[model samples]
Target: MKESNYSSSMTGLELAREYYFQVGRPMLEAQFPEYLPKIAAGLVGDGSECLGFDDEISRDHDFGPSFCLWLTKDDYDAVGEEMQHAYASLPGEFLGFPARNTSARGDGRVGVLEIRQFYGRYIGAEQPPKSLKRWLYLPEDKLAAVTAGAVFEDSLGEFSRIRAALAEYYPEDVRIKKIAARAAGMAQSGQYNYGRCMCRGDTVAASLALNEFVRQAMSMLYLLNRRYAPYYKWMFRGLRDLPILPEVPPLLLRLVRENPLRAENAWKAEKIRNPYLNQADERVELIERICVGVIEELKRQSLTSRNDDFLEAHTYELMERIRDPELHMCHVLEG
Candidate 1:
């Protein structure tokens, strides 16, 4: 039979939603009406598609119409295996797309997932971390993954409830702690080390320092906006959407692109009028400008009151703002 004509523009999430409603949902209603309300279905976890960042290139693998059906442990024990079988029996081809070509490690991305097991896999716990220390330690990208994408229907409320709690973002103390760490990292890497590395003619080290600065700065922006930065692969892609530091991305791009390493011959020649030195100077100034913007935001958010241009100075002040005694006492860089 000829394929249907749905636009190729349909994203993975959209395709999953449609596939669930048109195929999965009806299958559940017909064969397991008693279990319908207990299932929480959605496309989430471990995919660019979940974050709505998938494109044509993303279709090369693990890219097709598939959604997760989360069931409570009790319900899963009773019918999980049978439900999985039924789900597997559904149409392989949906809309205009081929069946998912799941890799060896991609088995659990979709299909019947036990609620606690699914959450545990992504978050290290079935429920949101209750302790400030726990919250401080959980990986930000993992948190982003657990909460990304949509929960189509969660009448059981167990899965959605935990997800909603996690989606609220980090506790204020945890955020402050993390922000303080980023501030310290930005200072040590970009403000203090980038120039020094350039002076020593260690262009590779300078580039590494600048890279660390960009990563920390991007993470700080996400913390400031109360969003969890995704995995490193998508960090910059995610940054463009942040409400804070909208201008910082361009500066960061220039910091990486305008490296002294790119002009190595000038440095090797040891010329008095090295254009590469000028480029290095320009990067230092850019680093300060970025730091000033971050400091201003820190002051505006009441994270720090210090007026210092060096971010390390503000790091101490921000760390002191953490109300939790245990978290406050941990290394300022611990977060």
Candidate 2:
């Protein structure tokens, strides 16, 4: 049960895809050739591997060679058990990688899966969400999971086609609503309450405010890029890939690492700040700078027309631009 130190050049997703191609596919072809066209195979869902962010350290637990074989309900009823047994019978190791340890039912990351159930586990629905509320309610991270990872093979085209449509950006109204909500959140947490909390000597509250600001700011960045934010564990890594606001992650890291209250302590030291406090002040400055950058992008995208550092105003402006009458009438900060 000890962790492995072996670091392969390929990512876990790559390893899984290789395993499927070199071994799983051939085994299936020999044993269940007729079933090939009815199944979709890939490495997707619930892991850093699925997002292609796995590193050497990621090979600790629940990390190894594996891929999913997704079948429609009709197909599952016919050959589900046989397919599972066949999948389990593959080599315990592949290309120098160790074999997967069997997980309890409903807990395994790989193997045969019903296509609807596979999607339902992430998106709360077996089918693609068609309603505005359903789309709005699903977490961005969950959406990211459903869409992340590569589908190595899909002879039936059912899975990939649905995935392609889901991968598209939200409707204009949905994007505007989300952007405005996140913008308002940033304004409340960073612009308004952060300073007030600092003035009250409530460093704890100030830290929470900083966290909220960072959280909302990150979401806003993903919305601007029209990309779903991955789970928080890989958010900064995901943020680095955004075409817009790519530099914000490092700035966010600094904010999270330094204490904002340190700036006041530095001012107290005969008005001569120490290097540590200087760094803290610089982080605070970067917060405002990030807001400006986001504002510029919002205006560039024609989502807003406001000209101020206040994010709430930009939120309102964006809300006004929403063409959907019903969405525009809801609370300006409503998601």
Lowest-sum lDDT 10-residue window in model 2: 270-279
Q: What are the per-model numbers of colliding residue pairs?
A: 0, 1
Q: What are the models' TM-scores? A: 0.94, 0.91
The local distance difference test score of model 2 is 0.80
Candidate 1 local lDDT, residue 335 = 79
lDDT string for model 1 (133-248, tens) is: 98888888999998998889999899999999999999999999999999999999998888678878788898899899999999999999999999998999998889888999
Alpha carbon RMSD to native, model 2: 3.6
Q: Which candidate is the best by lDDT?
A: 1
Residue range 212-284, candidate 2, lDDT tens digits: 9998999999999999999987887888788897778788888788756566575444343433223235555
Query: Candidate 1: minimum summed lDDT over ten consecutive residues — where?
Result: 271-280
Pairs that collide in candidate 2 are: 92-99
Instruction: List the global CA lDDT of all models.
Output: 0.87, 0.80
